[model samples]
Target: MRAPSGGNGGNAARLWPGIGGLAALVALWWLATGAGQAEGLAARFAPSATLASAAGLLRHPDLWLHLGVSLRRVLLGLAIALLAGVPLGLLVGGVRAVDAAVSPAFQFLRMISPLSWMPVVVMVLGVGDRPVLFLLAFAGLWPILLNTAAGVRQLDPRWILLARSLAATRAELLMRVVLPGVVGSVLTGLRLSIGIVWIVLVPAEMLGVNAGLGYFILDTRDRLAYSELLATVLVIGLLGFALDTLARWLHRWWVPS
Candidate 1:
C-alpha cells in the first residue's frame, strides 16, 4: 500500500488545537455563567447575554462607525510611526556613534508607559484625535525604529561592497539593496507596532474622543449595558486578532518561505 500523504493530516493536526481551545473556552464561559455561579454585575455580562448584545450591535450602523474611527486612528498612527521610525532606525543602526547617542534615550522612553503621558498629552493637545494619534504613534514607533536599525545592521557587508563597486549612488543603493533587504525586518516591526498601537488605541479613544471602541466601552458602562460592554470587549479582541493575522499575511507575502 502506498503511504498516506501527510498534508491533510498535518492540516488537521494544526487546526484541531485551535478548535479545541475555542471549545474549551466556550465550555468554561458557560460554566462561569451558570446559575448561582456568576452573580451581581458579572451576571449581566454572562456569555448568552453578551452574545445577544453583540448580535444586537451588529444590526446597528453606529457600531461600524465606531469601528471605522478606531481603525482610522490605528492606520494614521502606524503611518506616522513608519515615516518617523524607518529613517531614525536607519541612522541609528547604520552609524555606531548615532546608535550610541540615541539608544539610551530610546530605552528610557520605551520603558515609560504610553498611558503615563496621557495627562500631559491631553493637556497640550487638548482632547482630540491628535492626542490619540500621538499616543499610538509613540507606542508604535520604538518597535519599528529598533527593528529597522537591526535590519540595517544585520545586512550582509557584501551587499554594500558590491553596490559600491558598481558605483551605485547613495539613493540608488538604499532603494535597490537596503530597502529590499530590510523589508522583512520592517514588516516584523510593523507587526509589533500594530499590536502596540491597538492596545494603546482603546484607552486613547477613551480620552474624550466622541466615537471609537474605547468611547463606546465607557458609554456602555455608564449606560449600565454590561452585556454590550462585554460584547465590545469581544469585538476588540477579534479585531486585534484579525489585524495581527493581516500583518503576518503581509510579511509572508513579502518574504520568501
Candidate 2:
C-alpha cells in the first residue's frame, strides 16, 4: 500500500508539468490580447473583445438551451456508436473470413475524414438532427470497431480451451468468456470514439440546427459577441475533456488494469 501511494505521488508530480504548460498558454493568450505584447498583431488579427463581451452572452437567456441541445445530440451519437461498433467488431474479429472480406472496406472508409462525409450526409438526410447524429456516429464508430476486433484477436487461447474442456456450449463460451475478456479493449475504443465524436460535433452543429454549441459559436461570430464566443469555445473544450475523463474513470473502475 505504501508503494502504491508512492507511485501515485510520482504520477501526481509528473502531472504538474502539464498544468504548468497550460498556465503558460493562458499567460501567452492574455499577453497577446493585452495592449503590451501583440498590439500591432491584435490590430491586424484581433482576439476580439471576448473577455469583456463574455458576461452578457454567458448570461444570455438562451445559453442553456443551446448547450443542452448540443449535449443531447452528442450523447445520442455516442450511444449509437457503442451499440453498432461493438457488435460489428465482434463479427469481424471472431471469424477469419468475415474479417478478411469486410475489414479492408471498413478501414478504407474509416480513414476518410468525418468532415468529408458532411456534404453527402446533408444531401442524403436533408439537414436537421438526423444528419448531425449520423456524422457524429460515423466519426465515433471506427475506434470501437478496430479496438474491439484487436481485443478479440488478442484474447488468450487458453481461456477458449478451458471453456471447451468444461463442456461449455459455443454460445456460453462467447457470452461468459469472450465478452468480459474483451471489455477492456472495448472501453479503450469507446474512449477513443468519445474523443472523436466531441471533436466532430462542433462542425456538425453548423449544419443548421436551431440549437447546440456549434450553432452558438456561429451565432456569436455572426453577432460579433467575442466574449460569448470565447466562452463557448472554452465550454466546448471543457465538455470534451469531461467526456474523456468520464470514459477514463469508467475504464479504470469497471475494467481490470
Candidate 3:
C-alpha cells in the first residue's frame, strides 16, 4: 500500500491533538462527576444527563422559540451597530478633526461595562426587547467602530490621491475608494461584534424579555431543571461556535489571497 502524503499526515497531526484534548476534557468532566453517581449536584448535572437533556430539548418546541428570539435579538442588535458604527467610524477615521474631538470620550465610554448601563437603558427604553437591543447594540458598537476607523487610517493614501486627481466627486471617492478599502476591517469588526453581541444577548434577555435563551435558562433554574440548564449552556456554546465559523468563512470569502 502507498504511504499517505506529507500534507495529509500534517493535517492529521494538527487535527488529532485538538480532538484528543477535547476528549481528555470530556473524560475529566465525566470523572469529576463521579462516573454518574446519583449523589451530589455534580452527579445530578453530569455530562450524560446533560447530553440526554439536550437530546430531549431537541424535541421540545419551546427550545426553538427561545433560540429564535435570541437569534433575532442578536441580528437586530448587530444591524443597529453596523448602521451606526460604519458611518461614525468613517467620520472619525477620515477626518482628523473628528478623531481628535471624539477619541477621548469614545475611549472612556467604551471602557465602561455595557451592563453598567442596564439600569439607565431600562429606564430610557423601558422593559421588553428594546432595552435588550440597546444593550446588545451598545456591546457590539465599539469594536466595529474602532476596527473600521483603524481600517480607514490604514488605507493607502495613494488611492485617495488617485481618485481626487481624477476629479472624482466626494461621494464617488467615498463610494468607490474608501468603502472598498475598509471592507476587510469592517468585516473583522463584524466578527468581533457578533461574539460580543452573543455574549451580551443572554444577560440582556434576562431583563424583561419573555422569550429568549436567557429567559429559558432562568426558567430552567427556577424549575430545578439542572440537566436542562446544562443542555441550554451546551446549546449556547454550539450556536456561538456555528456563528463564529460562519463569520470566519465570510471573512475568508471577502478577503481571499
Candidate 4:
C-alpha cells in the first residue's frame, strides 16, 4: 500500500489547536461556573440558560441587525485595503528607488497603532462608519504592502531577466508573472490584517454607531445584563474564529502555488 500523503495529514493535524482551545474554554466555564467563583456566573454559565438566551437572540431581528452593521463596516474596510494595498505594494516592491523613498514614511506610519488614530480619525472623518472604516483600512494596509513588497523582491531575478530578454511588455509581465508570483504573500498579509480587523471590530463599532455588537455590549453593560454581555462576547469570538478559518481556507484553495 502507498504511504499517506503528508499534505493531507498536515491538513488534518492543523485543526487540533482550535479544537483544543474551544474544549479548554468549555471546561473552564464548567469549572468556574460550577465552583461559584463569582456572584452571577453560576446562573450565567448554565448551558441551558445561555443556549436559550442565544436562541432568543437569534429569533429577534435586532441581533441580525447588529451583526449586519458590523459586517458591513468591516467588509468596507477590507475592500479599501485591497484597493489601495495591492497597487501601493506593487509600486514599492517592483522598483528600487520607489521602495527606498517610501519605506521610511510607511514604516513610521505603520508603527502607529489604529487605536492611536481614533481621536484624529473621529475629528477628521467625524463619528460614523467613515472614521471606523478609515482606521481599519489604515491598520490593515501596512502588512499587505510590506508583504507584497517582500514577495516582489523575493521573486526570482531570472524570471524578470527572461521577460526583458523576451521583450515582454510591462503590462504583460505584471499581469502574467508578477501578480501570480506575489499572491501567496498578499494572502498572508490579508490573513494578518483580518485578524487585526477582527480584534478591533467591536471597538470600532462601539463608537456610537447606534447598532452593532459594540452597541449591544454597551447596552447590556448599562443594564447590568452580564449574561447578554457574555453572549455577545462569545459571538464576537466565534465570528472572529470563523473569519480566520475562512481566510485559511481561501489561502489553501485559491492562493497561487
Scored by lDDT, model 3 comes in at 0.93
Q: What is the lDDT of residue 244 in candidate 1?
A: 100
True-vs-predicted CA distance for residue 42, candidate 2, Å: 3.7
lDDT of 3 by residue, 1-257 (tens): 99767988897989999899989988988988887775868866899999999999999999999999999989999999999999999999999999999999999989998988999999998999999988999999999999999999999999999999999999999999999999999999999999988888888888777999999999999999999999999999999989998999999999985
User: Between which residue pairs do clashes occur in model 3?
Assistant: none
RMSD of each: 2.0, 2.8, 2.8, 2.5
Q: Each prediction's TM-score against the native?
A: 0.94, 0.89, 0.94, 0.89
Per-residue C-alpha lDDT of model 1 across residues 1-257, encoded as one tens digit per residue: 99887988988999999999998998888787774377777778788788999999999898999999999999999999999999999999889999999899999999998999999999999988999999999999999999999999999999999999999999999999998988999999999999999999999898878999999999999998899999999999999999999999999999958
Q: Write the per-residue lDDT of candidate 2 for residues 104-148, one digit (tens) a residue.
A: 899899999998989898889987999999999999899999999
* Full candidate order by lDDT, most accurate first: 1, 3, 2, 4
Instruction: Name the better of 2 and 3 by TM-score.
Output: 3
Kindly report the root-mean-square deviation of model 4 from the true structure over all alpha carbons: 2.5
lDDT of each: 0.93, 0.85, 0.93, 0.84
TM-score of 1: 0.94
Q: TM-score: which is higher, 1 or 2?
A: 1
lDDT of 4 by residue, 1-257 (tens): 99877987786788788689888977777676764444564677555456667778778788899999888888888889988998999999988899999999999999998888888888898887788889889878888888899999999989989988999999999998899899988998899889998787788777847888888889888987667777778788888888888888888887635
User: Ten residues in a row with the worst lDDT in model 2?
Assistant: 41-50
Error of 1 at 203 (Å): 0.9
